[model samples]
Target: MMTVNEVSKLTGVSIRALQYYDKIGLLHPAEYTEAGYRLYDDTALERLQQILLFRELEFSLKEIQSILQSPDFDRDRALDQQICLLTLKKEHIENLITFARGLKQVGGMNMDFSAFDTAKMDEYATKAKEKWQHTNAYQEYTQKNKGRSKDAEEALARGVMLIFSDFGKCKDGDPALPEAQALVKRLQAYISENYYQCTPEILQTLGAMYGAGGEFTENIDKAGGEGTAKFVERAISIYCK
Candidate 1:
């Protein structure tokens, strides 16, 4: 068994946070020593690891507590989902960075599409196609992106993120405006071009996910500035409707 101070140092979670978790019954130590110290066994340490994972995914402590206490909680399934979501986050961050770099190269008013080439993108899309080939939701994407060129794929990612930045500039604009609708159309077409054929149903789901407070949401927010994710969701809602 390890003491609370030891667990704090090992896990980088503050002793105060751990104490509060114990107080709220979120995490309980394995035993109490004669000196009134908290002693956590290996099982407790493992549980704490799971809690940190959920926290990293932006789950509120209450939500995490409920999830852990639920009879249906599956650690493996949860970890898998988190892994997929975080991977998407990393991809979005990279795409957003590429978008920003493009702006620096071509000036903010006009984007030089050539800055993002096709070869790298095509390869990435090919990899995505392979990854999702067995999934029915991405059949169209898989088939369309097969043997596609790298330049086309790269431009699609850059173009989409740039549009997101434009959307940030339109925070006050109506989602139903002609320009906004047009942008959403570009978004749909871009996805269909570079990744999958994003049907209205899929686009709507993506809009919601962009506002869902994970990496996807953060990516859009970063590209479009504050409130961009929700704006995109609202715009997509109208566009898809």
Candidate 2:
């Protein structure tokens, strides 16, 4: 596990910015020490890499958070897109360098602005953003959350965690127990009512994420207890079947 200071030094992201990312739910550390210092694992670092790449593409923090949190988010696919965008940026820069060098050699006005055009890069970025942001679930979530107050949004988040807290209470018991199954039902209903439709497929994906050892797991375990996320994932798996 790496401390927050280590992460800052390694990634060159300011400690303050990391703190802000935590505050805004952009990037959460893997865990916290008893003394309340943040600790991160490889998974968190990988997430930070994704954030940095998106930032290089000029994506806003909000956009990055949304893309990362999306149920449809695919790390491999995102990396592929980031690589393509970076290559395009590199090509644009090389073109500009060549253009500048030619102008200097000629020592006269060359008025060739073609090197500055970024239409290809811009088009690719727009399409990528649309793919990340316009998923049917995301569109529904956006429509449902339109005009919601910040406090209301937070309250909804708290409501979801409270369900996880209930899951924590039964972590030691059989996940197929009636109470556990009931909690799964409640969770599905709550998500369908608030965020997006909690289809069995989506819920299964979310269950995997809950135990996947990152922010969602950390937050769920924080709400419940250690192993709570995994227990919930098991329960959800049974419920889905």
Candidate 3:
């Protein structure tokens, strides 16, 4: 048996979090010394390892507790399921990267169905539940573009990204310049043509989101360079003003 401090050092689980786990009945000391110090056995350490694994996957503490305490909990089976889910997520990310590269190569002029179909893009979007897909812009886009052919959608996507690519090259330029504002205009028009009726208000919101980071920031920065996202935001400000 090991004391709480010893367990903390061995497992790297903070003493405070361990104490909270013990208080919440999620993990209790296996024994107690005469002086009332908590003592954990090897079995307890093993359980703590499992808890950490679940936490890494973003499961809530309460959910992790409940699942571990479930009558039918099967550790081996749970590990198998986690492996499968992680593998699927990996595949989804890899496919998106490949599709993005292909789009960049298309130059926004012609549709490329060499490796991916339009339906496939839609299918992946649904499965990934990307951040943009949750936005009003996406909703408006889908609604406006409804009933459009897959080929049309692919062409529109390439056109939109081409504008973004231009923005990527002007990270240090003034957003108020004709070139920057012109690209912003093209971006708005392209959206209106394909996805939704992008008013000035909608375009402004998109500008904020682009610089706000995550996939949008990453994509924009990839097209232009480091500050390209902020450049787009500034240009949108000028255009929408």
Candidate 4:
């Protein structure tokens, strides 16, 4: 585990920015020390890498948060897109550099402006953004959350955490038990009612995320207990089956 200061030094992200990210639910540390200092594990660092890559693509903090939190977010697919975008950006820069050097050599205005054309890169970025943001579930979430007050959104988020806290109460019980399964159903219903439809497939994905040892797992465990997130994941798996 690394302290927040360590992470800041390693990633060159300001400590204040990291704190803001935590406040806004962008990227949470893996755990906190008893002294209230933030600590991060490898999983958190990996997430930071993703965040940086998205930032390189000029995604807004809100957009990055949404994409990272999406149920359909695929890290590998995101990497692929990031790679393509970076490659295009690199080529564009190289072309511009060559064009500038040619202009300097001629010491006169060049009519050729093709080096500045970014239509292809811009088109790819637009398509990639659409792929990441225009999912039916995302559209539905946007529609449902339209005009929602900040307090209302916080209340809804608290409601979900409360369900996880309830899961903590039964962490020692069998996940296949009716009690655990019922909670899983309740969670699915709550998400579907307030956000997007929680199909079994999506729930399964969320379950995996809950236990995947990153911010989601950290938040769930914080709401519940140390093992509550893993227990909830198991319960959801059984419920989905």
Candidate 5:
């Protein structure tokens, strides 16, 4: 058996982090000392090792917890899956390193990207499906946004980006000014033009998501600047209200 500190040292994780894991029920101690110190037996250590390995392979904490705690989880199957993923990652990283080293040697750029491994492309698609399935809001967004044409959507998108760009210039928490309101109107018209029958409910929900969701945050930040998405979202809320 090992104390929490010993386990932390062995795992190279902080003692505080181990304590947090224990608190969160992610990796509880196998035993407790008379002095109330946490202790980990061989089984607990093994579990910790698996958790660490899964984390290193880019599984989220929640994903790891679900997999570990699931009734159908098999140790051999888990190990096999981890090995497959890690091998793919290793191959990709090796290719990137080779490319970088070659670039360093050649000085000027004449590199071909045709050697890109497309074998793991389906992994991202699977992950995206799983992510969309996890949230009703995101699923709804996907349903609404999916299958919309590029040509039809581009005008609306341009209008929305302009609003976001203007919003980025404004101070946070300030009331939506006349110019913002006018932009919101244009955005609503654009949505109506594309969405066939844009209901207030759908518009309101979308506006709320744009205001609060990290997806919109990233989108707006990418387009204009950080907080531009939030500002546009707020303005949409005001206009819709």
Candidate 6:
């Protein structure tokens, strides 16, 4: 058991914010002591952890409460998802900083958007690819994606995009219907064509990763809308089963 102050100190959230959360029922204490002092237990501590995660994800307090109180709420899953998002945000910020530095190197008084040339991008790709080839993570990704021709991979990507583009047009539970099932089959076939025997577990994990990670979200959302990504995730989940 811990007091509100203890939780504030442990989490680096201000004491006032913790008190406000209690008042708003966002992270209420387990019970109040006889003297009216708030008391929190293990469950409350865990809830606080979730609230902190929402803050890090830039969710408003109201949004955090709704998400936490949802039937599908899962702290570990939320944390895992936030970690993926933060990682992608970190990478994008780094890239932007590097681009800014490149502009500075070209003796620009300010960010010279005009100086940004796509034609010069190929000059950096060789070094970037060489660096990735030497990294364990890139090597693993390469081996995982190997054996598929570039053209075949591109076609598979297109098939997946087509499914995303048409997301949410069908009625609820339509994924089990003939047309939806056909789409799922097409997606499954694309995976099989690109990779060596994508197992059921692999398919399920890929769905989770898609929801958890920002890059996957960006790609799927670009294919259609944000709902399209969620629909793809649900379809993948059902197909994997």
Give the alpha-carbon lDDT of every model: 0.72, 0.88, 0.70, 0.89, 0.65, 0.62
Stretches > 4 Å off in candidate 2: 1-23, 28-46
Measured with C-alpha atoms, the lDDT of residue 105 in candidate 2 is 96
Per-residue C-alpha lDDT of model 3 across residues 63-140, encoded as one tens digit per residue:
566555332244675565556556656665777688787778975753554444345434543443333244565556
Worst 10 residues of 4 by lDDT: 142-151
Name the 10 consecutive residues with the lowest summed lDDT in model 1. 128-137
> What's the distance in Å from true for residue 185, model 5?
63
Candidate 1, position 9, lDDT: 94
Q: Candidate 5: which stretches are off by over 4 Å?
A: 110-241
Flag clash pairs in model 3: 168-224, 169-224
- lDDT score, candidate 4: 0.89
Model 6 residue runs over 4 Å out of place are 96-241
- Per-residue lDDT of candidate 4, residues 1-241 (tens digit): 9999999999999999999988776787877889999998888899899999888777888788777766988889989999999999999999999999999999878999999999999998888888878897777787787677757877999999999999999999999998999999999999999989999999999999999876788889889999999999999999988
Which candidate number would show the highest lDDT if scored against the true structure? 4
- Residue ranges of candidate 1 with Cα displaced over 4 Å: 1-133, 143-155
**Cα lDDT tens digits for candidate 2, 86-126:** 89999999999999999989998998799999999999988
Better of 2 and 3 by lDDT: 2
Residue-wise C-alpha lDDT for candidate 5, range 1-241, written one tens digit per residue: 7988788878899999888877655777866888999988776887788788767556676556555543223457556656776777777888878888888998897658844764583484356336424544333433555565545445655776776676666636554788777766766665555443345565666666666644346557656677767677677777777
Report residue 98 deviation for candidate 4 (angstroms): 1.5
TM-score, one value per model = 0.44, 0.84, 0.42, 0.85, 0.47, 0.41
**Full-model lDDT, candidate 1:** 0.72
Top candidate on TM-score is 4
- The TM-score, computed over Cα atoms with residue i paired to residue i, of candidate 4 is 0.85
Clash numbers, per candidate: 6, 0, 2, 0, 0, 0
